[model samples]
Target chain A: SQQGEEDPQALSIQEGENATMNCSYKTSINNLQWYRQNSGRGLVHLILIRSNEREKHSGRLRVTLDTSKKSSSLLITASRAADTASYFCAVGTSYGKLTFGQGTILTVHP
Target chain B: GAGVSQSPSNKVTEKGKDVELRCDPISGHTALYWYRQSLGQGLEFLIYFQGNSAPDKSGLPSDRFSAERTGGSVSTLTIQRTQQEDSAVYLCASSQGFGGAEKLFFGSGTQLSVL
Candidate 1:
């Protein structure tokens, strides 16, 4: 089953602009992961932030997790047209299964 | 070799027909998972397998859906008597282990169309 919800279901931005997506969950998680999916393709793991870590960075991607608030956010800096796609946040709990959010659709206009 | 792979990129079958979708996970990965994503819907977990132990089949939707991982490697998801509502993308994901720190590597998925 799906674990959470993502706000601003769709966002449009121009190249070089920053894009931000938010996710909120109900249960405590060990970690949260961000993934990107291009049209008609599979998802690619972008970055992962553990519960102990409030924030993390990978290349142009920045992810922030707030355990107390039970929410997380993904920020893409200097967005490119190639970065246009759907972004999803998967929360990992003590259980082995990973529950995902509805995802945010990001469109970067060139 | 670096990512998960799936077969038949697309599959179209008539109602009441049975279809098999295959997934070849990353080499040496100990955990594999199956998920189904209907159009405009969040992915639904179908099943998961870890090593040689019993699979976690709690997420399967119905008796029509079943999966098996052979030799702890390649896996297959079979849907019997498929219905129009079953049309969706079947995704396969695998990880190094069943741990909170493990990140899943996903396959492109097979787009199934049941008519």
Candidate 2:
């Protein structure tokens, strides 16, 4: 079953611009994680924010979680053409299970 | 393994036939997961295994689908009497342990096409 739902199904932006994507899920979670998939290949783990954490950052990525609203957002600073890919948000559950979202396709034009 | 690995990057089978996909997760990772992704659709959870615990198979769509993880490492996903709807990419992932909120390392996945 899918719990997370990413908003802005698709986004197109130019290089150097900051791209932001959002995700919403139903029900409680232990943590929320973000991944990147290039073309149709495997997903690369980007970042993870625990339920207690309001925000976290790694490299050019920033993730914010709000348990009250059941929503999370991912921001990419200085978007690059190489960053063109589909971003997914997953809600972590017990026993190593994770419910994923439909994902947001970000296209960074060089 | 350095990373999660999947076999037969691509497989095409006819309807009514059975197909098996394999995944070799990173060593020492006790958490394994299988997910299906249809074209232009979000990942659909299939099953998950945590260490020595019994697997969680609640997300399986039908009886035709089943999976097994041997030796707490290599995992296999089998589909019986395949259908066109089963055509999708099967992804495998593994984490350090169960319920750690740890990151998942994903395999390239097997592109299964049922004709």
Candidate 3:
């Protein structure tokens, strides 16, 4: 069973606009990481937020984790057409396994 | 190699036949993972191998699916008696550490088509 579930199965936005994606998990996690897949080929690691951390930032990507709510969010500022892809949230447990969510398909119009 | 590598980028096999997919992880990485994704769907964890430790096979959908990591570097995923339902993209990933918090490097994946 998938541990995480992402909201907004699909989103369409214009370049230069900000895009936000949400993910909710069922059980406690040691950390949560986000990944992006392009052309259904390979996935690229985006950002990771440990259980003890509340927020993290990398370039235009900002990630937030709320352990109490068992949820996380990813925000992409000033999106570009190249930012279009499928974003997945993966929950990392103590067992050394990562469970991914259904993912959100983001389409940025140039 | 500079990154994870997978072979046979595309495969088309007849039902009931067996197929093997290979993954060569980044040098020195100790952890490897296999995942499957159907069209327009999220990835489904298939198996995991860390060092010499026994691989975690809990996520494998059935007895027909199996994987092995040799020399702690190259890995192979085999599916026996393939069925149409088994058609999907098989992805491989590797990490530098045993913990889930470690970031993973992925391969381009093998697109399996069970006819």
The TM-score leader among the candidates is: 3
What is candidate 3's local distance difference test score? Answer: 0.94
lDDT of 1 by residue, A1-110 (tens): 33868887999999999999999988878888988887746888899898899999998888998889988999999999999888888888766778777788999999
Residues A1-110, model 2: lDDT tens digits: 43899999999999999999999988878899999998777999999999899999999999999999999999999999999999999999654579889999999999
Interface Cα RMSD in Å, per prediction: 1.6, 1.6, 0.9
Tens-digit lDDT string for candidate 1 (B1-115): 8789999899999999999999999999998989888887677778888888899898898999999999999999999999999999999999997744689999999999998
lDDT of 3 by residue, B1-115 (tens): 9999999999999999999999999999999999999999999999999899999999999999999998898999999999999999999999998758698889999999999
TM-score of chain B of each: 0.96, 0.97, 0.98
Looking at model 3, residue B33 earns an lDDT score of: 94
Better-scoring candidate (TM-score), 1 or 3: 3
DockQ-based CAPRI category assigned to the predicted complex of candidate 3:
high
On the 0 to 100 scale, the lDDT of residue B6 in model 3 is 98
| TM-score, one value per model | 0.95, 0.97, 0.98
| lDDT for model 1 | 0.88
Badly placed stretches (over 4 Å) of model 2 are none
Clashes of each: 0, 0, 0
Alpha-carbon error at B32 in model 2, in Å? 0.3
Candidate 2, DockQ score (0 to 1): 0.70
Candidate 1 Cα errors over 4 Å, as ranges:
none
